[model samples]
Target: MLNLLQIEFHKMRYNRATKIFLIIYFCLFFSITLFSSIRFNLGEINFQLAEQGIFNFPYIWHFNTYFAAILKIFLALVVISMISTEYSNQTLKQNLIDGLSKKEFILSKFYMIIALSLASTILIFLVSLGLGLIFSDFNEINIIFSEMGYLGTYFLKLVAFFSFCLFLGVWIKRSAFVIGALFVWWVAEGIIKGILTFRKQKYGIKDQISQFFPLEAMNNLIKEPLTKLGIVKSSIGVVNDVNIYWYQILIALIWTFIFVWGAYFLIKKRDL
Candidate 1:
């Protein structure tokens, strides 16, 4: 596994565009802390986000992970670029000629995906821990470590999403079109859910069915964290409360397997 990742990173190391995108991705990720300085002044209602206690111990874990997942699109671009270039530069053919088996090639890509996800997960843990220590009201060790499960969900979300991007990149072979394909899949899921709910008197079936979709499975890992804030209800807007369930992690894991396997199957069969 270590050797596979080293080979993939070696390729990325010399790719100027990949390096630039990675730098930009991390910069945007760290910039998320800038939310602490956000202010909202609506006539007689003045509010500052930093005072909202979102940076509180357990809450900071969920908040940071949610936004880190959002910044994942930048990494998705990197994933697509790597796969697209492998084909465009004829590296895939060259590697195969140089004695790399098809299974190892796919394994190498999957290893790279896991490495990126693990690194991002560690970054979130450190950043959230730092912010919580500085700003949280409770210093109890239990409270500090309470919501660490969010980190797992965040890691799973990245792996699944990037795997989907990898499948698209290998199948489509263009970064722009891969993104377009992602958007189309997202829209299709929404449309399918809409049809399932068209003038229906119930939402249970719709919700249950939508949960099976790839993107929906990933989204279920982390529901919106913003609505959990007090100011959102008192000032921002009325919002519904969301529950965090452990089963969503399993759903995401299954989708990740499907995506990675699908990509591997494609490369195995294609006459590279």
Candidate 2:
């Protein structure tokens, strides 16, 4: 695994496009996170949650996880570009000719996906912890540790989202087309969700199926903390509003498996 990762990094070292994407991704991630943290810490935005310690221990996990999740698209683009570049350059076939098994090639990409997701999650965790310590009052262990499940939800969302992107990269084999299709699919799903929601409200329809959409399922894994901060209304009730749903996490896991399996199947069966 280490050797495979090393090879992957070695390839990335010479890839100008990969470097450019990564530079933009890190800049965007840091800029957004730092700006939000500084703004909230400085009281630039008036909100009741800040007083109740929304940026404080425990609660900070929820806020930070959400902010970090917003950057997953960058990671997705990284995966899409990497795999698609391999396809474009015919490196995948070259590797196979050089005695690398198909499975190893796919697994190597998966290893990179896991490593990137874990690194990003841990970095955001540390950032959130540091900000909380510097700005929030020391509270009880229970209060400081509660709602940490948001971190797990955040991690799951990244892995699932990236796996889906890998599947798209393998299936589409074109960076621009895959990325554009992903954007279009996301927008289409949002439109379908909205239309279904409107129908449910206006026609009194009982089908609540919109949440089952791939991205929507991943999103339902983490509800909006702003709603709990009294900034937005809870679609469900306040009692169950801030909590992460196990079923949603299960759905995300299932979809992650499907996307991964689909990618492997397509890669194995198709000609390079």
Candidate 3:
């Protein structure tokens, strides 16, 4: 596995698009962290968020994780571009022709996905720790660690999303079409959830059902802090309350498995 991952990394090391996207990805991610933390530290944000300790010790984990997760799409685009470029360049076929088995080839890509996801998670963790230590007024260590679950949730969500992206990349083999489908899927989920939310009271549709939607289920792993934004109800234009369900983690893992299994099936069954 290590040798396979090394080969994958070598491929990425020479890919200009992968490097460019990574640069853009980290820049946007850190910019968000800095801007949000600085504004809150300077008392420039809305009173509601300020009162909620948006950048404070314990809550800093949640705030940073959520914002950092926003950058996952950039990583997904990089993954898609990398995979699709291989198809375009016939590198995947060359590797197999050079004696790499089909399973190893696909597993190498999955290893890359896991590594990238972990790297992103670690970046978020470091930034959150730095920001919390610098500006947080709390001195208790327990408070700083209390909301750490969000970090894990953020990691799982990234893995799940990227797994789906991997499946898309292999199945479509076209970066543009795969990315477009991703956008449509995201928007479609929001639209479907919105419609279901609108008819919730009439049909007794529960909020939990929305979590079953692939993206929605991954996102639901981290419930929005009610006091931070206070816009969940306002934006949704519904009075429905969202609670953090622990099982959503399990649901996300299941979806991740299915998506990865789908990728494996497609890669193994299809001609390279």
Best-performing candidate as measured by lDDT? 1
* TM-score: model 3 vs. ground truth: 0.88
**In model 1, which regions exceed 4 Å deviation?**
38-47, 198-206, 233-241
Per-candidate local distance difference test: 0.86, 0.81, 0.82
Top TM-score model: 1
- Residue pairs in clash, model 2: none
Candidate 3 least-lDDT 10 residues: 45-54
Tens-digit lDDT track of model 2 for 46-72: 543344555688778887788678878
Q: Candidate 1 overall Cα lDDT vs. reference?
A: 0.86
TM-score against truth, every candidate: 0.91, 0.88, 0.88
Residue lDDT tens for model 3, 147-204: 6888788889888999899989999999999999999999999998888888887798
Better of 1 and 3 by lDDT: 1
Best-to-worst TM-score order = 1, 3, 2
Superposition error at 261 for model 2 (Å): 0.8
